[model samples]
Target: MKKFAMVSLAGVVTLGMVAGPATSLASTHEDPSTTDYSDVDTGHEEFNEGFNIYLALTNGDVILRQGDQRSEYVSDVQRLLDTRGFSTNVDGIFGPNTADSVRSYQDTYGLTVDGVVGPNTYQSLSDRHPYPNELFRYGDRGEYVMEIQRFLTEERGMEMAVDGIYGIETERNIRVYQEYSGLQVDGVVGPKTWDSIFTYVR
Candidate 1:
């Protein structure tokens, strides 16, 4: 009877070990590496699914969907979009506003209207929208405005913040840049000014 009891105890311990692992597995799940945000319908929901896609845009490895953070890459995208006539604030955030602008650009350029900045969309933007058509002067606000500020700060060796607003300091720098680049001395960023600036800096 003692040996029989010992055998039954061993069987119970074996069953407990098996059940412990199973119970643990049942209660645990693998953490998802990336949030799947493709099925988001509303603009509000789309903005809520923000992610970071700040990698280089080589071969479209870094996709800018609705929920991407406002990185320098997004700033570049906004510059391109503003150049192409889809006017959206170049605030770097990939919210519904940016998505709507991207879709407009895609539709106008005969690309797929998925509201995503992929390889094809990026290529189209790079190829077509080379520069902003409108004049970027004092009081102008956008990524391109910031780009001019960046060019002034980096290439021409100026000391200032690269804020997107075309404030008095930015205008002063633009005039300086224009004078240095042999362009018109006006503190405006039209096509000719942009051409000269791009030639000098980019």
Candidate 2:
């Protein structure tokens, strides 16, 4: 295993291990200091490899192609494709179906109809359905709320309906997740909460 260090704004450093060298570490976030890198490993080589891909995805530096290994980042790209009306399975593996979907998306968007998801294709999809940046609290409603609800349910195993409405139940679940993540136990979803959530999704 090879050790890597990620430092936070508070001057706290956490270490993780990967079975091989990381592919990329580029980022587009305005303030990298807000991101938390605590769950980057599980002491297993296979799991660490997936986590390395996840980190690159969150950093906006991943270049996925056909025949790539399984990783959550591939699943994320599949989800984005499906959201744009190109149906594809959300399986973690980047197989032929995913490549076909990427080609279709690229063709429709007037991009080079290559199956690979390099920087330009990824940026176009991101621009179309950009991640939510506004602060969220009780009574908010829309796709952003649904995004957080889905993240909480899928990633954190929180039992809640992804109805795109921030109600008491949603706030309660957010508070629970905040407390568990060692963040401020406030119900509002702000920069810190978004950073933590995107650590898994981006």
Candidate 3:
């Protein structure tokens, strides 16, 4: 009888060990990593962080969409699309033409063909044609300088020629705007100045 009882106890212990691993495996299958977000909206907070980081790095904070008002953010997207040979007006307006261009860009780039410029679309655009991050000083010249000229003229009420030349007038305007905006007033379009300008524009 003692031998029989010992054998039954050993069998019970073996069964418990097998059951423990099975239970652990079942729990692991229900882990949060396996959770499905398919039913959730793509615009939810969970999915916007990456795109928000992209915008913050690029000095943009708005998610552009159709029928949105004219702003510098829209102009940035339009410029990016044009740079990629998508050919849309850089008019700072999210019109139908811009939407069609965005869709075409999305289709060509193997992104979702949604007309909205969401995080994924922005990532693809940035990957292909990154925004100019070079420092712009008094002697800089190009489209970025022209952008500054336009910003000073249209947003800050400064009368300057948008001729893509960062001459004395542009530097002076930058310093004045910097002083007025309570920035460092360095007269250089560095990250801080760019952020200040984009923050005000957006």
Candidate 4:
């Protein structure tokens, strides 16, 4: 529960909001104004060229800029907030709450305190563990978990019915797995469980 001070960008005075303690911040994106694509006259294709798709963050953590307004990126930011126990609306508005959460994230990760997602901030996000989507593999047994089941059946020789239902048998199997791996034998497919499951898959 560290406190963060929001400073205006009068000068480039970023205090490494995420990774504090004087860790140097890196700027991976070009100096172009990273803002909403709607304001520019450039066509979609041109904007796509400079859209920085490779800079997308999969985790609920990111370096958000002060004035960005992309729907997809806003979704990413919202996801980050949700992952970190914040229940803010994911409406891509870049409002005050998002700003405060970004400040908290910056302080947590020790990034520049600009509250603007930049390259150095993006790098910090990439290194985070327990990303939001990782939980999808457990519940619902959707496409992702189904894929995991397939890998388990083919590789681990565990005779699991691929019915996409995480019931008692699945939990039992998971407990057996955790016990075998010397993990907390709670029968849950947590991050450590997933990592151990990978060993069996290959």
Candidate 5:
């Protein structure tokens, strides 16, 4: 009887050891390094599903479709972030990974990460782009603004200061150029006005 009891005790201990590992595995999940976000939520339950917040800001409309264009914009932003050394899922869904990358960018650029790209965020992204970002700006204070000032003063012969100051002088020169180009003389360089300026300057 003692021998039988000893064998039963050994069998119970073996079962417990096997069950312990199984229990731990049941409670644990795969590490994110091996996990994929494409298999996760698509960020559709909340606001406009595929409408990228940044493009909406640029176009003066809120995107509500999680379609190809939205995905493209998100992909572009993610690519920018990746170039900036922030690794993200890049799944075209503006979820936690994208939000975190935006926060990282915001923190670096002194922006507020309420997760919405406003004027300041847009300016920051556009001003520091890798290539010449002349087409996507509207007179914010930055290197491109300085470049615009340089173009106006040197190429356009406006006798204006190239100090990156969007003061009355700059506005006047912009309006003058707009009138010359038969634009609306709004003193603001929209896409069409900007294209005209470059066409004339070049």
Candidate 6:
């Protein structure tokens, strides 16, 4: 287990608290996942924008694979793979380690063992692999917890290392997210809290 020095934030928090007074819920509207991908062959402006939108959509094209192509999408897939327990360096490089992890994921999820993230593989991964609504608290350590840390870092703009250890820093970030999402300001991440985060992602 990696040790992270817990940093204190300016809030009165008691560890493991949940179910407080309800706060104003934020609008949980997710934008439609629509994108025109007819121009991927032309490599024009349409191709560029469509390809990017395709990548951003969870059910996007399989442009990321075991090669030297580097992008934030590769890094995002790496992070999701790390969260699913097929550990690989999250350096945004789709190297052998990432390929091996992808293969492992394919095997575990009953997908084709091609070591490539094509449409089928990507869809299965996007749908099946991610955990849904797991309660996270301090002293817990694993990819599940690491996911929350990653969300705080990537989505919510929190400054912290993604070490998979739920310490004070992680809890502090969760509290911040809770406050921002208009949910109860408890550090614990239950289904409601998870839903709030998911709404933001969509």
Clashes of each: 1, 0, 0, 21, 1, 0
Point out the worst 10-residue segment of candidate 2 by lDDT.
Answer: 14-23
- Each prediction's whole-model lDDT (CA): 0.59, 0.63, 0.60, 0.48, 0.48, 0.57
Which residue pairs show collisions in model 5? 50-66
The digit string of per-residue lDDT tens for model 4 on 1-202 reads 1122323356543222332223211243221222222332213342232224324442324445656677667655565555556556788877777777777777877777776766565445323232122442223333334444543453344556665445444545555545545788665565766755543211
After superposition on all C-alphas, the RMSD of every candidate to the true structure, in Å, is 27.6, 16.1, 25.9, 21.6, 28.8, 12.8
Candidate 3 has an lDDT of 0.60
Where is model 6 more than 4 Å wrong at Cα? 1-57, 123-150, 154-156, 160-192, 196-201
Question: How does model 2 fare in lDDT?
Answer: 0.63
Model 6 collision count: 0
lDDT of 2 by residue, 1-202 (tens): 0112333336643222233222222232222223343542212343235446555654558889998764667886787678668888888789999999999999998999989888678756544223344677766565566777875665445667897667656766676667656788777888777776545332
Best by TM-score: 2
Q: Give the candidate number with the greatest lDDT.
A: 2
lDDT of 1 by residue, 76-121 (tens): 7786688667988888889899999999998987999999999788
- Deviating ranges (above 4 Å) for candidate 2: 1-54, 58-62, 126-136, 139-144, 151-159, 175-186, 189-202
Question: What is the TM-score ranking, best to worst?
Answer: 2, 6, 3, 1, 4, 5
C-alpha displacement of 43 in model 3, angstroms? 33
lDDT score, candidate 5, position 33: 28
Candidate 5 lDDT over 1-202, as tens digits, reads 0010011253342111221221222123333223333333222222122123444544545422223246655664565466457676677766676777777888887888665555565545534223232332223344445555665554344546775545545565666566555787666655666655433411
How does each model score on TM-score?
0.39, 0.50, 0.41, 0.36, 0.33, 0.46
Expressed as tens digits, the lDDT of each residue in 109-135 for candidate 6 is 898897877766655554422334346
Candidate 6, residue 83: the lDDT equals 63
Colliding residue pairs in candidate 2: none
- Looking at model 1, how many pairs of residues clash? 1
Error of 5 at 19 (Å): 64
